[model samples]
Target: MKEFVWAVSIICILLVFGVVLLKYLSENKKYKNSSYGKQSQKSFWKIISNQGARGEYRTSQIIDKAPFKNKMLFNCYIPNRSGDKTEIDMIMLCQKGIYVIENKNYSGWIFGNEKSKNWCETLKGKKYFFYNPIKQNRTTV
Candidate 1:
């Protein structure tokens, strides 16, 4: 009878420990998922604000304009400094050589010259300066 009692106590202790461990693991997973969800939402908004969809359309236009062999590919990736990082917009692997292109879409009255450090966009005569996409694309290429 005493041996049976000891076995029952051991089993009860093990059950309690298992329950605590399971709770901890579940809480950790919930926390991780919430943080990841927040990050993904932020990234999605950034993409929309940056007009990434318009850029893709512009890239398609550039691909159509370029003359290359039928087999040459467009939108091929070029490796950047990082192993997983790539500066991919439009690429054509042709008999000439590899060509890298970056596309930008701006929907306002462009109000700056080439000599200007910052280019301004005038929408209804309200001017706002934006980052120079030419410099950015040069670096991206």
Candidate 2:
């Protein structure tokens, strides 16, 4: 009976894993066909797994729904004077001017100011620190 139970548990785990993989594949195919995915250089795995990538994709969708005519570039890399590259999440070009976007997807209460190098996210009872998005975008711009 114990052996049978173990086998059933293993089968159940495999089934759940299979379902998740299939869902991921389906979403990836759909994203690849979308205009936002075509413009984004980020891999499908990154889009699904990384919070920042997902945030950028969500921002792109919002931009697409806007009434104004604009061109959007995603996941852009610009060479800096220090020989390293600065990555910009999204750049929107319109009749007004070019706008640079730094996307941050964080839950809970976030605390930070423009001058702070790092920001704190209070989730549950814990605190998490992340680089300031404003500072990050300032370097990119």
Candidate 3:
């Protein structure tokens, strides 16, 4: 019967969703238990799903392993000239001075000059344009 088929389909869909949710939760727990994850202070889903987050997390991991005593901050927001908040990916405080890091996680042939407002990335015969990191850092600092 049509009603019986519909009921079975719905049950199957729910079962699949439950399984996926369980798997995601399990993975997230494992990530949270790791040292990098703890330092990142981000959920597994967040780091894995967002490219920028993944870049920032990886940068944090590298900074943690460095042979120096430094304080690092992530996802910091500071007010700009326009009174709007600009998010800085990472910041490092050390004996040298304060360093602001703008991470760009792009996989391709990147082309841009420091003065350019935007940059280009060519991957798989496709081009992607993004704001220049140099100008972005200038604005943040």
Candidate 4:
């Protein structure tokens, strides 16, 4: 009878743990779907910095360490005919032609094709839309 009682206690404990885990996951999912998750992080630096900026910063850091650092420009802006400014992430002036480079920093499971106008990503049941960088960059290039 004592052994049976212990088994019952163990099962109850495991079931409680499982329930708690499920609740945590569900709460997390809800949080992600909420505006709190959708809202961009509010910080003094966050205002000036972002994922794309961070990615470009990382790229610059790498280029700064490279052997050919003198041939690249970072965050170069060009004015379009429409009086709008187009920001190029990185530009490599080569003998052949000026190469326009675009960078994107992303996490989670990315789901999109090369031709898709919009790319989608799923992170813990949340979905995000990002414009196709290739297509977007082609206009400036």
Each model's lDDT: 0.56, 0.87, 0.85, 0.68
Ranking by TM-score: 2, 3, 4, 1
Flag regions of model 1 displaced more than 4 Å. 1-50, 65-67, 70-86, 113-116
Highest lDDT: give the candidate number: 2
Best by TM-score: 2
Please give, for residues 1-141, the per-residue lDDT of candidate 2 as tens digits.
Answer: 999999999999999999999999998887787667997777898887988788777778788888999998887899866779998878899999999998899999999999999999999999999999898888874
Can you write out model 1's per-residue Cα lDDT over 7-92, one digit (the tens) per residue?
99999999999998898677545433432222233342343355754465435444555666522243445655555455555555
Indicate the residue-level lDDT of 2 in model 2.
100
> Which is superior by lDDT, 1 or 4?
4
Clashing pairs in 2: none
Q: For candidate 4, write residues 7-53 as lDDT tens digits.
A: 99999999999998898677556434433233324332442257875
Q: Estimate each model's TM-score.
A: 0.43, 0.74, 0.72, 0.55
The 10 consecutive residues of candidate 1 with the worst lDDT sum are: 35-44
**Cand. 1 TM to true fold:** 0.43
